[model samples]
Target: MALQVQIGKTELKVNPIGLGTNAVGGHNLFPILDEQAGRQLVQTGLANGINFLDTAFIYGPKHSEEIIGEVVKENGNRSDVVIATKAAHKMVGNEIVMDNSPAFLKESADEALQRLQTDYIDLFYIHFPDKDTPKYEAVGALQRLKEEGKIRAIGVSNFSIEQLREANIDGYVDVIQGEYNLLNRDAEIELFPYVMEHQISFIPYFPLASGVLTGKYDKNTNLAEKRGKFFQKELFEKNLEKVERIRKIANEKDIDIAHVVLAWYLTRDAIDVVIPGAKRADQVLNNLKTLDVQLTVDEIQEIDQIF
Candidate 1:
């Protein structure tokens, strides 16, 4: 069995490396996706000992959870997997808006339960903080759900430090998900200490910085067009230099650079899970390679300095 770690103070124990299901049925996010391939990706992950499956209501707007539900039901492994999903996006007459109100949060959890085809969610997050709802009040709703046995744990995503503070005011929050990776270390400065103090597990999304930390891109590659605005010319070139340094360590260890990167995150404080999304079965298998990588303290510091 893959080694298990606790998610915050919750009773849920999951493999440190989880499958991020945004690409599973996120046809709306990525053009020209194959639903069959997406199912294969989940099957491959579960077969290989990955127990944590992270999804959200906004991904495919609902399809990701539906697909995951079908796969879990077909495999009859619902009890074996620790499924984590998020909400907060509500349809508003052909437009989507963030809603953290208590009623909406309660309604969203019930709807997500249907989409996931499960009696209870392992971890459910408030995907984003709406402008109106008090953060604590929103989390209070999820706390109620937990108490009623509708969900197992409560989480908050994309929340600022202050918002996280308010959400966890009652100490009901179990995990916090946000953008974090080797290239982006802001969480280390702003979020880690707080979560560490509160005993909340931190699950980093985009753990590979959307593949930039994978050490596959070259200086000439146009990442801006491919990845997004964050990879503009100057910043991309600087990050490439850092990736090269990590590539040397990866080569020395005889492992894939992406594996080295993921391994490094596991060593950091308060980071309990790293959910890297994959579109192919092979890619899903590749992510599992991260578990075998054991970095020395000096190497960890070297990687820390490189980024």
Candidate 2:
């Protein structure tokens, strides 16, 4: 079953367990997947009730969006699902440059539209903040997209609470995509509450903590290279204690560790979406099951104690 949430002004019913394509798009140190398999993964993810697919122009430098275009076009249910993508760090003269200017934002959205084979994007985000650019300039650009029907909603990822509040002053920032999970409660302190107060949707990236909170990796094993940013030796050891606590609760509930982790987020006040990247069909199936596993108020309180 798919889950629904109010994504700012737009009311969208998406799979609470979104399928992240970071792995399929060859965005990591791992071997790149075949284009066919990548497309198939999108199809299979949708078949398994995953409606939210997050991609960025930098995901394998646009190869991921291209593959999604192929599969979304092949499936022809283009309007039935939500297609979200991001752009801001454009490569210029072989150097990375942040271009949150109106012209570049418009250009980038148009390029994504062409690559995704869609006329209008359901959701779009500014990948990361460029300290150099004025935040309102980016917000104005997103507002323009909404007015022109290029994108339905606007959001940002890897943003701080101050940044989000600044962006939405001119208008409502539809979605706020930040790193949030059972292990990461930083968002809860400020970003999550702000979004809740303003009626903006919260899309938590790394909702699985790059798989550390998923309990798939332990002290002895390594994680996928896509997760290298979070797989620090010290961080890994620190996570072991949290992992054991999560696992103990999950074992008593007879649920998968990942499900337990996701359920905790679902109970959060303002979380509208959780975009966890997936590589296989079975993973997508497991993600969909999260919507059915309800965590009651008492269970939620118990889970909070471990965090």
lDDT of 1 by residue, 16-123 (tens): 999999999998898989999999999999999999999999889899999999999998968999999999998999999999999999999999999999999999
The lDDT per prediction is 0.91, 0.79
Expressed as tens digits, the lDDT of each residue in 52-107 for candidate 2 is: 78888888788788888888788878877888899988887889887787788899
Q: List candidate 2 stretches off by more than 4 Å.
A: 27-29, 222-230
TM-score, every prediction = 0.98, 0.92
Model 1 misses residue 293 by how many Å? 0.4
**Considering every candidate listed, which one attains the maximal lDDT?**
1
User: How well does candidate 1 score on lDDT at residue 189?
Assistant: 84
Residue pairs in clash, model 1: none
Which stretches of model 1 miss by more than 4 angstroms? none
